[model samples]
Target: MSILVFVEQRDARVRSIVREVLGEASRLAAVLGGPVVGVCPAASDPGLATLGDAGAERVLLAAHEAFARYDAAGYTLAVVAAIEAVKPQVVLFGASAMGRDLAPRVAARLGVGLATDCTALAADGGRLTATRPVFAGKAIQKLAFPRVPALASLRPKVFAPAAASGRTATVEPLTVGFDPAAARAKVVRMAAAAGARVDLTEADVIVSGGRGLQDAGNFRLIEELAEALGAAVGASRAVVDAGWRPHSEQVGQTGKTVSPKLYVAVGISGAIQHLAGMSSSRCIVAINKDPEAPIFKVADYGVVGRFEEVVPALIEAVKQLNAQV
Candidate 1:
């Protein structure tokens, strides 16, 4: 009947994945000629009302004390309840950590098929289909859903956030009768590092460094350039393993997979493991002293030079470009 979008929030803030999912939902809704309904779990968050700007005609909010913090059981049940009510032909979620954890539970509860980490969606022949990378992004597979209420989780940044429509959304209260005793895992407290980082998975642009940086001190090169470019700082697994950077900043098979619009690799001799994580990035620029590095094979732009010599110049150049803007 409608396209149901799961709105994910954290620390009282709406996550970018939610907006990204909404943008895709808007596109899908256009194809299906259906209205977009957003389902949010929480008490009245002021931010939850903004989904209308992203294409929601109406929002169903389940505001309750049990939803103040995430309880896997409580949240899952709330979503299932919303799904049962909406009875939509398609559902959309961002392929975020929360979405990955929750989408499966909802799909199982509804006895529906789900496609995870989808990079693309198509309205083909009056039906929706999804495409995802397989074999660690080395291959692509298109999926067709044979049932109504088919679920799909989108990879962040694959679609631009929809422009705000400047219309106020009608918010309705959703009822979630959650029982705390059913939840085994509970969030007690949350702490952040002194400096909050732009998560690699969510960042639109990333500047990552590797072992060729020589030591932790040289990481300033990556940081400075990232600052100039308004990009997140990422690190190769080698740099993280060597204690040159935090594990949270690591990007590779063992770390976070990112598909940012722009990815800059500095001194990272690209290993297959690392490529698998970021190969889907829209634009990749690799800088290395060794031109023969495997990273050059996949990089859209390659620079053969010492990062120390090149990064400062690049940072200055970016500053100049920004000043012009």
Candidate 2:
């Protein structure tokens, strides 16, 4: 048996989540005594080195000029072709925007069942079991795969990157025949978000604000706190829908799921959808005027107060600590 992992890259750089996914694949492969193969679709991506370091026995690069921009249909087709060629028993993806968009497409093309956004995966008795949160994270569901290639998209940060054992794998080119322009969805005009901070998925510490921010201007306080702690700034779905922040900054079931080491939720009553995205954080701090808010149930610490009063004091405390350091 062999495991094939799709290496997710951006800006010609391998995202940290890809390394984590590779580590996860390596562990799964070890348990099943399977070889691990990494796949990257790019014309010239230097991040291939990191994949080799992550314990991939072979890294396959699918070079095409059309891959410069992400096309969901084109990428899915390329992945399907790669899987056919490699004939891996299992496949994995980093449950990011691209993975979320591409995984189902590949599964459908291959006429297989795929477990989406899996928090944990294990193979036993020649079957793959995928564990994922369901019902707004109120329950975790473990399901078995009944397909030729067990397909799963792993949530970012759920698996830690294993140690590099000083082995570099051979890089190979994938032979895929497809037309990029023939894809259904064409990503047009992608504008970068302003003042990019640490990636939310990769951040160890995250300071997130909610509807309690009131307006977009109040987000400056959150940004200030994030900067002081060297953390990423995240928002609840309410704030993102209100246009106070970009969709990328939103953390909820309908948005990006994150599991930072420390999560600070301000002025946001924890909804089930919101908790589904961040309940996996190592430590949670909830600051809300209503002490009975559902967020407190999952939070490690709680502060009952208004954001207008609490945020300034928190900022000052962070600043004082920084100055002392």
Clashing pairs for predicted structure model 1, backbone only: 42-63, 43-63
RMSD of each: 2.0, 2.6
Clash number by candidate, in order? 2, 0
Candidate 1: segments with Cα more than 4 A from true spot: 193-195
Model 1 C-alpha lDDT per residue in residues 78-197, reported as the tens digit of each score:
888888888888988888878898899988888889999999999887788999987777679999998878899998888777798987667888888887777778878667642277
TM-score of each: 0.93, 0.89
User: Please, what are the lDDT tens digits per residue for candidate 2 over residues 159-230?
Assistant: 888688677877888877777656666766668752265778768899999987788898898998888888
Model 2's TM-score against the true structure: 0.89
Q: How well does model 1 score by local distance difference test?
A: 0.87
Q: For candidate 1, which ten residues in a row score worst on lDDT? A: 189-198
Cα lDDT for residue 222, model 2?
91
Worst 10 residues of 2 by lDDT: 188-197
